[model samples]
Target: MSTERTTGPALVVQNLTKRFGERTAFSEVSFEVAYGEVFGFLGPNGAGKTTTVRTLGTLIAPTSGAATVAGLPLSADNGVAIRSRIAVMPESPGLYLRLSVAENLSYFAGLYELPDRRARIERALRSVGLEHRADDLCRSLSKGLRQRVGLARALLTDPQVLFLDEPTSGLDPVAAREVHDLIDALRKRGVTIFLTTHRLAEAEQLCDRVGILNTTLRMIGRPDELREQLFSKSIEIRTRAPLADPDEVFAALPGAEGWQRSEDGAYVLSVTDADTAAPAAARALVTAGADLLALTPIRHSLEDVYLQLIDTDVEAQQR
Candidate 1:
């Protein structure tokens, strides 16, 4: 079954909620993923990350909300249609140990009842750079090789949207990087990917935008945007010696909102604009007759953003 291209967002979810009896899996979650964009879904364990994927994937129905997956309304009636347009690659590929790489893909192709099965299988294997291993038994392949096979299976349908749940769960750095490269390749091919992972660095590196979830939608934006939203922009100034009168030097500086001295005798200035503050601070130090060592903007990683929100939730629960 071929999936026709759709115009609008690849996925649209509005106030989506899911509850299992008394336990709420996720509540009032909403987000959209653009076609050909890699949208990262991030959260800690038991934070409804998987549940959100399962819900959006149509494996489980939402309790009270509307969603459109692959341009089709998310409903029991559209389940088959939605499944046809999207593919889900779990952490484990779940291949038969006794089956050869080609045989495993052949099995799934049969399930999808795809046409030109041989041609599709060849293309899928080639996409993941596993054409050479088609004859190798899955059990004999390394974990990383097995992962490539899983990805190949996901591509057999040429899905409009691909959901990858921890695509690099457990592997050496080398193996993990291999999978990252494949994702990069797929993104360049204009494949829309919905990636769910606990690895903040991976999300930061791969996703165009990311949503941090904790039983609810906590935040959603580009990684840098999230950092700017949650953190104040600041410039770090290191000097050969502490300023003679730090307050006097930085107090009247343009674009600087506030200043603080670090334990290691560095100065950190909260700035409205680094472009404006950096040069001004440099001249201020020279005028004060202080030896300037370094002046640079401090950058916060996505992990910092993830922890800040998740930690806030923990503190609230404690209270």
Candidate 2:
């Protein structure tokens, strides 16, 4: 576990803006990731997710705005000083295929000049479940093993902040799950994580608070918070009968908005609150001569929130 250091903000950005030509990738973007926080950045394609990550990683300079990392100004060393305090696992990491796992870690460790280098390397290998393959070359390792090596590379820095950009992208489900387990372990060790992923479900599972940064940040909160914001006190009732016209049935409950049919001709009703709306909906279904088979609250997942935000923006632009 990491020993606690100074109690200050881990990373802070204010009015961060980046632009090129006539287009602006991101503007007026600001957020604070406190120590031990697993902050997530979510957005659709070209919504500036990668651009934002690149700027935060200090790989590129923001057009305007100020950011302080680990209590140091971001420009002192052209971001070098801040970069030293952070480790990054890019979305597509380029690994040295000819180098053994241990060698790869040592190569990075040597650059960072970490103390007790060999011991740190060994500890990181075991931490990511790569102890047995420490001697194997990267080229011969499976995709999952290679990912562990990438993580091991980052761990060599002994950084306070770890930037993971789509850390589990394109891997098999099992490998992705393993990556999540590693993240969980890292969080327990008190490493602040900034995770960016297109995978809404994974982000929902791992992030403490997620910011949907499409064009602008449409929403920022935990998965459950987003659910409550987008679907507060709402429920979907699935019935066995067609109930072709649900408007006449629910005219009294005018707050209900979205109504649709399930694949089996079962109908669904969207309401304000399940606790109150659900019982009334169940009664309404039965009164309408519709066979009520399942009267359960409909859960709006992160994907639902993501899609709604995206579609809502696209629609706004269309208008």
Candidate 3:
């Protein structure tokens, strides 16, 4: 999806810092959420993910720093203005048990003073595919549907940006998939989704760009960008030997790291770069008299790159 550049960023946080005495939750963090990008905010536990969002949401004042929402500077006079254009969904949006789904949605809509409120509630339920259950008590609904109602509440404002924290935490596989679908639909409609997730698959598939924040922002980019920058997006080879062992032949070749032998004694080799090393990797392995069973390039999956990014930060602190 093409994101239109905004008159200014959809959101901007500059030099954001938070501290509890000497225990700094974050230090001088800064980043921007553009007009129509689903930016994933992620980190390990206590890496200040929630702190950063709370600061931007104006739930708690930053120790020092500033943020703007939809071009309005974050100030006392405009904090309400900033919030008016944004929606914040906490990790757990425990709904009112007594209220029906429609009641719950209408309540939030009223809070935002949304016009044509009944029609908007209908649209929200339809958007999340919860129209069939719209009259059920929130407590009577399934966990996933409850979450969808929470989302529907957030959408009532038609906010330019939505901050979702662990929106699918307790759902089953099917439920998580449903929540994911909801998120994807919102992104397509050009609403910026700032999500904090332990669900790597969700982040990988849904986010256009991700910022791995430390006490400060550590790294930010599209998944592929960080993957290629931080790890080798290379290829692997697995082969069955015919007449000779691979090590005796491939051990001396340039760009070929040492080979690995599977439990069944097949050989697996790692190369520096797939495009550059594939031909040589192939020639060397084959000429070694090993039968090639599989030759596949390894792209840096989000799971792999996320570990690398988080680990790098952890190691820095350890040092």
Best by TM-score: 1
1 or 3, greater by TM-score: 1
lDDT per residue, candidate 1, 133-232, as tens digits? 9999999999999999999999999898999999999978899999999999998887899999878999999999999888888999999999999999
Off by over 4 Å in 1: 1-3, 315-319
lDDT of 3 by residue, 24-89 (tens): 888888888887789998877788899878878878778888888777887777878778778888
Whole-model lDDT values for every prediction? 0.91, 0.81, 0.80
Residue 181 lDDT in candidate 3: 91
* lDDT value, residue 215 of candidate 2: 52
Best by lDDT: 1
lDDT of 3 at 281: 71
| Alpha-carbon lDDT of model 1 | 0.91
Candidate 3, superposed: residue stretches over 4 Å from native = 1-6, 242-272, 315-319
lDDT of 2 by residue, 1-319 (tens): 3454456788888888889878888878888888888999998778788888788788888889988776677774757777767888987667889999988888888888778889999989988999999999999987877888898888887778888988888899999999999998998888999998988899989989889886566788888999888875555566665676788777676467666666765556666665777777777778889887777777888999988888879733543
- TM values, all candidates: 0.96, 0.86, 0.87
**Predictions: Cα RMSD each:** 1.7, 3.3, 3.4
Residue 106 of candidate 3: its Cα lDDT? 83
